[model samples]
Target: MSTRGKNHSEWDSISTLYHTVVGQLTIPIAAGLVDWVHETVPLNGPGANAMDNGCGTGIVCSLLKSNYPTLPVLATDFSSAMIDEVLRNAEESGWKHFQARVLDSRNLDSVETESVTHLFTTFMICLAPDPDQIVSEMHRVLQQNGILGLAVWARPNFGFFEAAWIEACHELDPTYEAPTLMDPEWIEPENVRRGLAKAGFKSVEIKAEQQSWDWENVNAVSTYFFDGHNPGNTKWHDSWTERGQSIDKVRPLFERKLEEAYGQSDGSLKGPVPFCLAIARK
Candidate 1:
């Protein structure tokens, strides 16, 4: 299978579980992009419209519905299951003027050239098998002076949570090594600038920002581990499976380490995910 095909299958298999697994990422991360869009060009402004490119579960669409209910919005993702979730959320939330399609970000052939007024992609850059292609596609789909809002996860994110995963894996198997989440260069603002500039975007601004989430308690955080739903947990499970190690072997250790990492005095778990927030003009 091609890279896009593999990603479609991987994300589709977990689509029903994805919304829950994203924890707070779906909203808080996308909120920064949406907020910036409002500052750049109000969704209700004359001739204004938006597209949540790679709209995982349509978090940005939900925010747009809340803040600018009448804005014509297009939500697209490679995973049809995710697009289905977007539609489900739309109907349940009484959204109007919303449309969604199964579209690959790398080649947005269906979206007309220089059409979208605002494009928002959250937490997707570094992970894209072809980030440059996606960036160029966003540039192509945007009207002149269109705003491209992007949010990408930076290094050392997930707080001590990642460290805890590593420690647990090592305890289970002495020589275990974790996969690199994504290329580190994409996390840097300079590289982001270069990529966007190469994609025909100028007048770009990028900032380092953070979004945080608090779980009920250590037990809840540990439970999030068992499902291995999120990428970190998925990696943790994959590492063990490849090593012939049972997930149960890592549970108690991961929980204890997790409490030590994210455990708050108030019996809650919290962490900061630092990200690169950028707004570019076409």
Candidate 2:
């Protein structure tokens, strides 16, 4: 079971913004992981079928189709908006072998048991209402000796941004409280190993690495957190609206904290992020 709350509607609301902003921002990471999957798995053989669970913007699916044109790819997401984007992109790219579907990760009833040869999910399991059930579903869908690839945020820390935002929010409204973004247990490598093992995966290997990106200035960081189409920002704005508080009241304070913690001498922000990559065999 997941410790974090599940909100399926949130993805639908931010689908467009996520594709245009957040999904684009994570392209490098997604591409690198795809490259790793290509090298780690035998995806070039005849009749190779791959599924991208929670395939946001169809980035990974696109990469797979480009690299192995003959491979059949199934890209699924919970958001209908996201599925539309994926299908549109696939059509525009002339990817005839790719398919997109609106799917819930925890219960992939549409997929058949032992039907998939390769399964890949990037930054998705952590958001599931039941990560364990999702893993079990993954195992159920994979054929014998099939490979599973997963990438999730690991040891996620906002550095100084979180404290700054919380403080600023409190200054604006005394009763302001931060919304929980993820289940902490999901980020731990051991927990991920246990979940996969419980789901009948074998030879699981989990690796953690630090990944970072730079923001041109505090404004960019602020835009990403407050204006970006992601769960955190959406929840933050919702909380403020529920409290009858204006985000503008704390914008300055948040910017000030950004400057204090991540601002470069030239007024830019350097953020170091962490992620965990895992692979297992069914």
Candidate 3:
């Protein structure tokens, strides 16, 4: 409960801004995850129960239902604000096949064991307090032969937003270990396969997708792209401040680096961001 409270607070603090920045990208990510799921799982059947864990603003749910109209989707997040936004979006979009719930991925007893037909997540696993526990819960919730689809940031091939964040975090503190690209470690096909196998899942497979973020304006790119993880806005605010550094101090360094890498843009900074999509069966 304490963990859930912290997750809820962290997400609630930036729910609006985070959603505005990431929601557009989520449509494609959700599509890619679903495509992987379809290829790995038999999703064509009727009355399939799918769970979208950590569904922020229900963007994944919206995209999933749009693609598969008959799937019974349980869209969940730990934050009430996120769930509220999801419910509102579902209502506005008239997504009757979807339902919103506030759920912590680390705890699956709230959801029946072996009840869900398919489990889906996007950009959520890394935020978890315990990635291994969350993955184990996902496996527990899944019915036999159920499918799992996940999208994570690829380390070496990730986008400028992440690259800049990495540089900024390091500049702030050379010894600081940056946040996990995905729970346990960075997202890799082989790593995901091994993790799933350890979780007692079978027939696990992973696919990689490289999605790019295009920036039109370079002036605001620093703030727009990295502010979510910016020292001032993130839970790491205290840690950054304790080290006598902050995103306020870190932005200029990031901007200079960007200029060096991409040159000055008139008003737009556009680049491709790559993401990895992993699919496994339980």
Candidate 4:
């Protein structure tokens, strides 16, 4: 399958569970990034129009609308279910002057050239089919001197549970290889800055920070990844199946390793995930 197709399928499968699972953990980080943008960028200027490209569960959208009540906001995602969640949350929050649409971030055809005043994408570029193309699209839609803010996972490592599962996969089948989820270069700050500059963005700035999450126990962490519901773990299981391997065979090993590395005296786990934040001007 093409990258776009695979991403859409994976994200669609997890849309319903995103808010209760991932969103519950990432929303605060999203809010903090939005707060940084609000402080650094002039968001309340007249004729300001903003976009949340690849707005997964609308955490950034909610923050944008709440912080800048009158700013017109457009939130787009490739998954219909994700857009549905955004709309549902918007209605519940009585948020006005906001629009949610199902659109590919790589090619934003609905938005006109040089129209948007600000663009924000949290945890979106890392999953984009073409990170460079997505950056170009953001540059295309932004007005002259418009601000662009983005958050992407840092490279060379996975989340705590993700690492545990990967280690188990390797131990179970010594020759097994992991799938490449996205372009590796996009995870590096220097590469991202270069891509933005090539896309016609200026004043690029990137910062790396660590974000931590706490889980009730190793079981909760394991359930979040291997319970046959998580899109990420679904891919892992499918890969194993294709290779004539059984993830079930490795489940116990994975759980034991996770408990040994992350388990606390109280049986809880706290995992730190790193992210890169970038800001630039069009």
Error of 3 at 117 (Å): 1.0
Worst 10-residue stretch by lDDT in candidate 1?
1-10
Off by over 4 Å in 1: 1-8, 21-23, 156-160
Residue 193's lDDT within candidate 3 is: 72
For residue 177, give model 2's deviation from the true position in Å.
Answer: 4.4
Off by over 4 Å in 2: 1-8, 156-161, 170-177, 240-245
Candidate number with greatest TM-score: 4
Residue 57 in model 3: shift from native, Å?
1.6
lDDT of 2 at 36: 69
Error at 92, model 1, angstroms: 2.3
Off by over 4 Å in 4: 1-8
Show pairs that collide, candidate 1.
none
After TM-score superposition, what is the CA distance of residue 169 in candidate 2 from its true location, in Å? 3.5
Best-first order by TM-score: 4, 1, 2, 3
Per-prediction TM-score to the true structure, in the order listed: 0.90, 0.87, 0.84, 0.92
lDDT of candidate 1 over 175-232, digit per residue (tens): 9887776656577888888888998998989898777767888887776667646665
Candidate 3 per-residue C-alpha lDDT over 45-67 given as tens digits, one digit per residue, 9 for 90 to 100: 75587888988777677767787
lDDT of 2 at 186: 72
Candidate 2 yields a Cα-based lDDT of 0.77
Backbone clash numbers for all candidates listed:
0, 0, 10, 0
lDDT of 1: 0.79
